[model samples]
Target chain A: MKILVVDDEQDVQVLFEQRFRKEIKAGEMQFVFAFSGENALAYLNQHEHEAVLILSDINMPGMSGLDLLEKIKKTYVKPPPIVMMITAYGDAENFNMAKNLGADDFLTKPLDFTLLKEKLKTIN
Target chain B: MNFDFLLIVFVARYLRTALKNTQQNSVWDDRLKLAMYVAIALFVASVIFRDAETIMAWVGHLCLLGCIYILYKETFFKPAKSLIVAILPYAVVATIIQFLQLVLPSFYRGNHSMVDSLKGFAVLWGIGVWMVTIKQKKELDKTNEKVVQQEHDNRIITAMKDELEVQVAERTAELTRQKEALETALQELQSTQAQLIQSEKMASLGELTAGIAHEIQNPLNFVNNFSEVSNELIGEMNEELSKGDIAEAMMIADDIRQNLEKINHHGKRADAIVKGMLQHSRSSNSIKEPTDINKLADEYFRLAYHGLRARDKSFNATLKTDYDETIGNIIIIPQDIGRVILNLITNAFYVVDEKRKFGIEGYEPTVFVSTKKRIDKVLISVEDNGNGIPQSIVDKIFQPFFTTKPSGQGTGLGLSMSYDIVTQGHGGTIKVETAVGKGTTFIISLPI
Candidate 1:
């Protein structure tokens, strides 16, 4: 499965790469990284249906995680990719709002790779 | 003959009573009595000595006239024209009687005696009228004196009342002036209080912006540390694989796994710190939560430094920190405590930056932040190697609206607000220590 990870922090790319090193080396998963919501949207437009999963952070400089989720859910109707939101704010308000905006899943940061791996296996 | 003597006695008695009623001095009384006795004696002599009767009668009339003059003079101070006019008829009658007695002795003896008696009666009647007039005049004088006394008393009372009114007006004016002055002072105090509150809000907003720059470093640091460790581990594993040492390679891989876990742990800590910061930014509520003191102090130190750097690019200061790790987490209102820390660190940076601008040779600007756990309290101190606070103004450093910064640059509420947050808000203590030229340190102690 191809997964697109979106975060403002550049070091997040390296972190995700290292965390999924075994999966990538074993050819079980391919990862793509975008440092902003705008870049992630641009990548999706260039290669439609290329990314089966989109992981995004909610609090970014521009085009917040919810906004990107709305656009993706509205535009990509055929075989729509799964969208997950990650936020430092784990409050019920943000969770409910993201859920209402059609977010497939919600995760709180310091993303648990163990749990995330289990969830990814189920999606497969 | 008996009627003449009775008439003379009656006139004498009337004069005595009038004199007594006049209330004159003893001298006048004595003289009037002598005159009365002489008149009576002469009358009695005339009755007894018939040959010299006319001469005695004339002398008696003269003596009565003299008594009348004395009485009138004493009562009125000077004899009035009416009294003199009343005595004139008697004097004229007496003179006529004397002439007739001298000119016609036999005829005068027959008719002149009757005329003389009638003249004496007339004189007595005139004297009675004069006494009555004197008494009336005396009563009138008494009434005038009483009226004059009443007018004088009324004038004095009016004057006193006017003076009292003037005094009341002056007192009222004075009180009004005091009230207006106090009102103006109160207005000024209210405006200054408003400005101080506004500046505090501005300071918190600045801190929030600086927090973004300071918070990103934690996750980045974790990523760098683990990445370098994993790189070294991969090299070791590759060498063991080339040497066909599979067990050793497996051990190295396990170690790498532990390092990755550590990286994950640090990443979670960064996330938690970010969440706390976001919560602090959102809520103004003073809710007590378990907070890491060292991390809080270190976070604010960097936040203040970065905030200053953003404003003035040329500014530079050496930062140092010594944190006590045993004080893991203490219960406190993290937002309030975080604001206080940010304020102190910002002030430290400001002082050091000011000293740096002086460009003193070999002078290095530095700010040091430290935390320690005592037996029952926690101490956080911020120190700056800048020109120390003068002894004279050291006590006023934490006073509201007292500032050393120039106009428009500072509101002077920073330290005062910090003092309130630590002391009044949290039941803590804040104090300052300083030297003339060395440096200054502010210490805050919070109960565990």
Candidate 2:
């Protein structure tokens, strides 16, 4: 399984890489990193159907996660990739909005990598 | 005739005594004395010239007319129509008796002595009547004087009352005008006070949001993730040890150690951010203490940068600092000075950010903060490479409520408050240097 992680903070890349080191070594999962939603979309456009799951942070400088999700859901409908939104605010308004925008899942920071791994396992 | 002469002498003596007792220093007194002398002369002439009785009588009549003229000229008794009418009949009868005595002796020779005595008696009666009329005129003069004095006092009282009423009206109008002015000023003050409170609340909210979202949250996320990763690494290490893979366990142990250090570093970062926020929120006690000026400036610079970045994620600026090694801890109110430093740095960043948004060609936004140790003072400066303030408004920049920013965007009190904190609270001087289209620098000089 291939996954794309999008966040504004560069440190999230290191954290994700370290947390999934076992799976990466076992060759069961592969991860790609993008610093912003716009970069993630650019990556997706260059390599279509390469990633099975997209984990993105909602709050960003440009091209927020919800916009990317809406574009992805609208353009890639035949083999829709699962998109999970992560946010510091876990308010009901954001949750409902994400749900209405066809987000596959919602996660609140500080994220639980164990639960995320379990969910990835179920998807696999 | 002898008895009449004696009566005239007696009346003249009585009038002289009355004039002396009254002490009336008037022309009327002199005239009365002259009349008394004339009456005495007439009486002596009448005795000396018994054969010239007609000449004596004529002289007596002339003296009486002179006395009447003096009385009229004195003006002490203004003769009214009623008093003149009362004396008219007496005056006519006296004149008729004098004429009859002079002319009837030739017509009726019978009882010539009786007629002469009758003439003397008539003369005495007329003199007595004239004396009584003078007394009555004096009494009337006294009553007239009292009436005139009362009228004068009444006119003065009336004039005084009119003046007092005018003054009262003027005072009431002045008081009313002052009351209206005070009420208007009070209303304006109340409205301004309410606006100030509202702006204060908004400013604090912005600070709180920036501090919580960027300063505390970022490091806290790192600390949590690093610790969780370390926990996982520890579990993996135990598993490898149980399998008797000593080399793998050592590798995992090393990773955990590095993770622990990262965790410690991130934890301290979060702790420092919280402490800085607490310091800002705490009310200033205005107590002077020894503080490292360089460290203080550096800390506030980072805080203001992060705060601005938290609000506007696209904002970017290069920060530079120069600190004098010789300048150590200086005694100052750290909190107040910190606020002043923060305010200046924030303003510097704001101006540069505004210029950056203008998309000037080859423009790079930069902020420089420097501290220098002078002979007997310390100087702190914040400089920004942004469009400089116009010369027209530069002088008014430190005045309260003076701002170039649009209304509601800025409370306009930030620079003024900073000026107060630097100059009044810390006993320092704040000055600004700027050049058009180049930049602005705010310098603060503090006595050692």
Candidate 3:
């Protein structure tokens, strides 16, 4: 399973890498990263239908996760990647918006990696 | 042949003088003229009717009485009230002539005609009374004219007083109306000023809120990311332990420690930002103390600059400060004056930031803050080398909600409220000097 994580904070990449290092080394789960919505879209453009799951932070400097989710849901029809939205505030407004924009899951920080792993395993 | 004729002549001459003195074109003039003619006729009848001289004497007496009455009418009845001399003689002569006519039949018949002699005496008496009445009438009319003139003057004075009172009342009413209008306008202005200040506060609060939101996220992100990754690393470390990979578990522990340090640092950074915001938002200016104006100005200048830079990473400007060390401390409401100084510095920073956005090659955005000690006042000036205000809008800059900044970028009450604080609140003066395309200087003077 290949996963794409999108966030404005660069530290999120190191954190995600360290968490899934064992899986990445075993070649059972692959992880890709993009710092912003634009970079995420650019990555998607080059590797269509490559990522099985997308995890995105809702708030960013430009092009929020909800906007990216809407764009992804609208543009990609054949075998669309399952997207999970993450937020810092855990607010209902962002949650409902992401859900309306066809996000498959919702997560709020500080994240429960155990639950996230369970969800990932179930989806797979 | 007798002395009575001499008296008669004297009365005729005096009658002529009275007529000449009172030559008025009225009923009194006609009456007085007829009396003069009657006096002459009485003298002629005395001569023609020597045998019926007694009847002529009576007629002469009655004619003289008529003349005196006319004089009374002309004198207007208020003066000449003490004319007993004329009335007493007429009554005595009339009574004596009637009694002698009844008692003595031979008194009328004499060789010299006793009736003619008596007639001469009556005519003389009539002339004397007429002369006396005329003299009294002249004196009385003079006094009457004076009284009439005095009454006339009094009426004029009363009318003028009434007119002046009315004018004063009208003026008072007009002034009251003007005062009421001014008071209403002042109240309206106060309410509008309050609303404008609130709006300006809310606008800046929104910007500060957004800045805080952006600032807190970076640290919070580190905290969130590290905690979650640390949890995963613990799981990985357990797995390594289960696999007997003690070295790998130790390495993961070291990475987690480094993440914790970053988390702690970012958390503290967010805490500092919140503390600064809380300090700024507190609205209290009641207490006053001696404050170092130079130190206060410098602190706000840096605070405003750093706050802007934190919110906008691309914003940059050169700052120059010249603070007077001799002007140590002045009594002031530090918070209120601090707000004014902060507002000025923020405006300076905004102007410089705007100029920088234009990307002019030779433009160097600069802001200068200075404090100077004068004889009786401490002067603080904020000078900026940004895009100076245009000449037309310069005069209205201190007006409430008057702003040249783009809509949603500024609420425009910064300088207006600052002016109010320095002037209305502290009895100080605020002045602005600006040149188009050159620079602007805002000076605030606080009296020692």
Docking quality tier of model 1: incorrect
Residue pairs of candidate 1 with colliding backbone atoms:
none
Candidates sorted by lDDT, descending order? 2, 1, 3
- Cα DockQ of the candidate 3 complex: 0.14
The sequence of per-residue lDDT tens digits that candidate 1 reaches over residues A3-68 is 999987666666666667668768999999887777999999998999999999765533557668
True contacts kept of each: 0.00, 0.37, 0.26
Give the per-residue lDDT of model 3 (tens digit) for B72-101.
Answer: 565542233333344435435654655566
Q: Which stretches of candidate 3 lie over 4 Å from their true place?
A: A21-30, A45-50, A70-80, A87-102, B1-49, B52-143, B203-250, B276-280, B284-448
Residue-level lDDT tens digits of model 1 in B1-448:
3233433455546555645545453665576466557656766777788887666666655664664565456553343445555565665676577677678878877886688787778678667766786787688768878888889989999999999999999999999999999999999999978766766756665655654554565465655657665886798789999999999889779868877876787678667657656755654566888989898888667666655654454566667899999988999888788888888888887887788788899787788999999999999999998898999999898898789999877778888888888998889999899987788999999999
- Per-residue lDDT for B264-369 in model 2, tens only? 8778877866765666655646578898889878877877776776666557677789999799999988766877788788788889989989999978788999
Show where candidate 1 strays beyond 4 Å.
Answer: A1-124, B1-143, B159-163, B166-174, B177-181, B213-292, B328-333, B358-364
Question: What TM-score does candidate 1 get on C-alpha atoms?
Answer: 0.49
Q: Can you rank all candidates by TM-score, best first?
A: 2, 3, 1
Candidate 3 interface RMSD to the true structure:
8.4
Best by lDDT: 2
